[model samples]
Target: MLKIRLKKKCKKLCHAVIAGICISGSLLTTSLLAAELGYPEKEELTFGFIKLTDMAPIAIAYEKGFFEDEGLYVTIEAQANWKVLLDGVIDGRLDGAHMLAGQPIAATIGYGTKAEIITPFSMDLNGNAITVSNEIWAQMKGNIPKQADGKPVHPIKADALKPVVEKYLDAGKPFNMGMVFPVSTHNYELRYWLAAGNIHPGFYAPHKGDTSGKINAQALLSVTPPPQMPATMEAGTIYGYCVGEPWNQQAVFKGIGVPVVTDYEIWKNNPEKVFGITKAFSEKYPNTTIRLTRALIRAAKWLDENDNANRPEAVKILSQSNYVGADREVIANSMTGTFEYEKGDKRAVPDFNVFFRYNATYPYYSDAIWYLTQMRRWGQISEDKPDSWYKDVAAKVYRPDIYMAAAQSLVADKLLLKSDFADLVDEDGYREPQKHFIDNIVYDGTAPNDYINKFKIGLKAGDKL
Candidate 1:
């Protein structure tokens, strides 16, 4: 009896061990699949953003539960200014933030602050405009030609404003203008417009310790926060300013200024803000990085899906006090596919705030190169660099590899169609040559040196301050 009982117990133990092994194998395969789908290593995240309509993606992701769908609990906070937002990301207080397209490139190249910040997402395109105070607008109106309907010709050029700037110079009054930041798209676009009309915006000489970009300026450009633009112009502190919406729209609503030219007119579909994070953050939390990017991509698609049918709802969310905090009417003026240049001059600018269409979310290396070219043009680089150097910096800062991985995962999950990302599958990370500047200067990003030399005003090869 004892022998028979012991034999029965051993048989039962053997069967139990076999069952355990089979379950372990099944779990191991499941874990591998989960890894392939990019399970988030860190779920709780805090992101920062400035109060601008271009920050709609971050807002939409949180409001729409896209982040929650990816197992990410996200908190979106508004920073006081761009500098604070950038510092929060650099110091790890915030995981990432909506950053000026130039911030990561400038930071990586040791322009303002030295940090290895990288962006896998370009937030939006063509959401900025140059606004001049009412007084200045009245001075420039006579120079601008009228259309058949008595409206000023669309894309009122800087040529109309040039004579006014010359008058300021002749009278020994400094013609001051406001850009949100030094390394901002507003600065470069404002400068490009001014230079195209034969007005010298100025140059920066950081090598000579003169970082004030007013070396030989015809119109002096200075920094002013976005929210303060209208008030500053109202106070007569600045004659004109270039900034992202709804600030420009706010100016029109308040009757303080008139938006002269949109950045879309300056350079059609130019890359704007980017979602930026530190390299260390990305390396330490690789899965989280891709997951967050995936969430943003989904949000961008939703924003632009159905020909922007969702934009009215998006504008309402952005108008909340916790987000952009502007009035709904003010925000909608630009967010809803139409921009009110003058208070009553509402025009259908359907592409004013592009989120996902035209591959606006892709972090193309050529976009990085374009910002670098502008940096060199304005004397921030203070030296000429080889085309290879431009390419190298672009590769370091714009991580399309991460972008593609996220895109592929989304397609696999059926959240995004493969056809939705057709340009992505075989992308070389460079945009085809762009030719839509207000001055009609064709930009070929592959030849940075040659493109820099083509500029009429700006440092070319072998030129330095």
Candidate 2:
């Protein structure tokens, strides 16, 4: 009786399997189907981010279903500060992070936390500005040439700000400035702006236990958290600050300060943030790494598609407490491509917050090299290095090969096209020497030392301030 029952059950299962296989023809390849299915290696993943508008890629990826389409279950968490966020990535608490472009380079070089962090995607470009308090703005307006509308003509050079700084100095008051972090783009951009105007933003002599960056400085620079920038300025602590939006725009809303110059004017379309992961994480889960990049790329395209028509919606989403937590109007001030200089003086500056267009998401070795060059230029490197050293360091930190693989996968999937990015056929990863700086200095990533030498101010090869 038992054998008869077993035979009957086996025959029934066999018949069902045969019918199912017949329903789906032999031409269907299960392996190819699985690849197209795009399931993530790890479904549940947490990504860490600092509270800034440039972190929009991560948020967009989650909200726009890009991550879901790729089978990535993601959670975006706001970190208290950069150090904590970087530490979270290093310790495996975060699978990856929204990071400063310099974070990977600084980490690989053993600047702050020694770990091999890699960036496959650049987040956005040109969303930062240098803002000054109301009193300082009053002083600076006298030095600047006014427009027909009584507003200062833009691309406001630090030259226009120098006189205000001097008056504070002559009054025996130290002019303090706030930046996000030591390895932050805000710090380098601020230093670049001030040095361009002949105002020394100072250097980091770590060998002498003087990381204070106030060494031989006309402006005393310090690290203030991003959200605290407006309040710090309002409290009369920092006279001015350089930071990513919407903090700069927050000052304009509060009527506390005027945003003097944008980083877009300081250096055109400068690389800002990057999506970073530990070398260990990438090596341990290579497929997961590529999958995440694909999701982010798609999200970036969605954000910038239709000429940023979606930004107002993005601003609303980011205004939620879980993300940036700033008000909608404040976030939109910069996110929507116009910035408020003085209260009710909003001007059209469409490139203020760039997400995807113009190859903004491609991690360039040249961008990494530029930050490294600035580090050496400002004594953060604390020693001399050859040009090859810069290239090697950039290669190790910025993984353009990984980026191309992800981009190609998107192209193959019909989600994106080749024309959306730079002509990568003969691409050598280095941008042609950029000459749009406020100081009019031409920067060739190929010749970092020569660029350093051109600067009248700043540390040169084999020299320390």
- For lDDT, the strongest prediction is 1
Compared with the true structure, the alpha-carbon lDDT of candidate 1 equals: 0.89
lDDT of each: 0.89, 0.84
- TM-score per candidate: 0.93, 0.92
Quote the lDDT for 401 in model 1: 96
Point out where model 1 deviates above 4 Å.
1-34
* Number of the top TM-score candidate: 1
Clashes of each: 0, 0
Q: How far is candidate 1 from the true structure (C-alpha RMSD, Å)?
A: 10.1
Q: How close is each model in CA RMSD to the real structure?
A: 10.1, 8.2
lDDT tens digits, residues 1-465, model 1? 000011111112112222221222342122332457656678678898888999999988887878866657677778888899899899998899999999999999999899999999999999999999999999999998999998899888999999999999999999999999999999999999999998999999999999899999999999999999999999999999999999999999999999989999999999999999999999999989988899899999999999999999999998988888899999999988898987799999999999999999999999999999999999999998999999999999999999998998888878899988997888999999999999998999899999999888999999988
Q: What is the C-alpha lDDT profile of model 2 across 134-237, one tens digit per residue?
A: 99888888888889988788878889888888988999999999999998899999999999889998889988888888888999999999999999999999
Instruction: Note the residue pairs that clash in candidate 2.
Output: none
> What is the total number of backbone clashes in candidate 1?
0
